[model samples]
Target: MLPYLRRLIRDEDALLQYSAQIRGLTAGDIYIGSYFSVAANWLPQIIQAFQQAYPAVHVHIEECANKVMYDGLEEGRFDCCITTWRPFSGDWIPLCEDEMVMWLPENHPLARAEVYPLKQLCHESFIEPLPQQDTDVVRILKEEHISYETRYTAIDNYTTYRMVEAGLGVSMNNRLMTAQWQGRVAILPMDPPHTITIGIAIPSRDGASPAVKKFIHYVQQGISQILAPR
Candidate 1:
């Protein structure tokens, strides 16, 4: 009976704490899960804005694979995620669209080609990135029935970029992934141009904590300003 009473008291205290945090966004924690590329390209500015608005609200970011990020969102382990939009049982707020492009050594014959032919992959040594995961590159190749030689398997896009820079092999990835990279790699659009939508995924905005809601709003605003016509 004493243990039950203590448990009830703890539950009530937790409820009270949650209520207070939501009533006035004075304090709360928001868990954000994202892909490495998304976190790198989109999170910094938005997070800065959010922090300025609510300094007391803590932001925790986790970088994970696409599947893991979406799984965490469904399991309530993540309040929100910045990732490529896919068919999931959640709400998605599109932030931007990214174009899929091929990476080649600057000295390669087709390096400056206007568009890389999908079938041409058959002649190149491909540097497959994240073979364990169905990344956009892998999915695009498979869906288009394009076959290539996987001479190297990179753990991430950065490694893939290095491999391509070293003339080890060619690769394909979203253009946004190369936003911060300065290496000499020729990025070309695919013969059949492919694009992916990247956005925020939330279980339910209506059920979000105050901090999470505010963070989402800031993300929307920040992205809007960045994407607006200059």
Candidate 2:
């Protein structure tokens, strides 16, 4: 491994690429914040692709609750953030839009239904995500005039998923975020159907570092194309 590392460092193309990435990138440190809901699916691919193109740039990720992540960007801690909801003001690069769906424990009675009306879920136990301000489950229900009682609250989104897997409650999750994996939950489309935008909120293109600009371009060129409607 050491020998291979030395060989890679000695390669002319690698050296040139590394040098080029550092030449104009400010701080050489790119901090990215992310709301976990969207990050779980898309962030890994974005990071992997970006790192391959700019190996010299150091990317620091702060994965947190939604609202907090947006705050972090405003506080100048993150050059950009990946979130489900876009605010009224921000320089956004839309990655993809996802359908909001219902998740039920395996074998739960409602799992057999082709679709679930938001109102029909009112009587079942609901698991609200913690920092509760960040997650959308509660907000969606409230907006639809559906009343529910919370049986549990989870700080980690996956922990909430686990609680659902345990048959404790039902909840809402995104289609793209959970696309390739179902885990132990049964996914059903919502009756009225809904969608959420998932994307990056950057400080601004004019004010961003070269590295940030390159990353945003990379995501737009690569990730967005993959996520394009078929």
TM-score for all predictions? 0.88, 0.82
What global local distance difference test value does model 2 have?
Answer: 0.72
For model 2, the run of ten residues with the poorest summed lDDT: 6-15
Model 2 lDDT tens row, 1-230 = 65455333334333454466567532255777876654666667877988876777787777786778776665655677877664735687777777889888987888888998888777888877664564666667767888788878878767878889999998787776466666889889998888877787876766566677777787677776676789
Which pairs in model 2 have colliding backbones?
A: none
Question: RMSD in angstroms, all models?
Answer: 4.7, 8.3
All candidates' lDDT scores? 0.82, 0.72
lDDT of 1 by residue, 14-126 (tens): 36547877676445667789878768987899888788878877889998767777777666677789888767887888888889999999999999889999899999999
lDDT of 1 at 80: 83
Clashes per candidate (backbone, < 3 Å): 0, 0
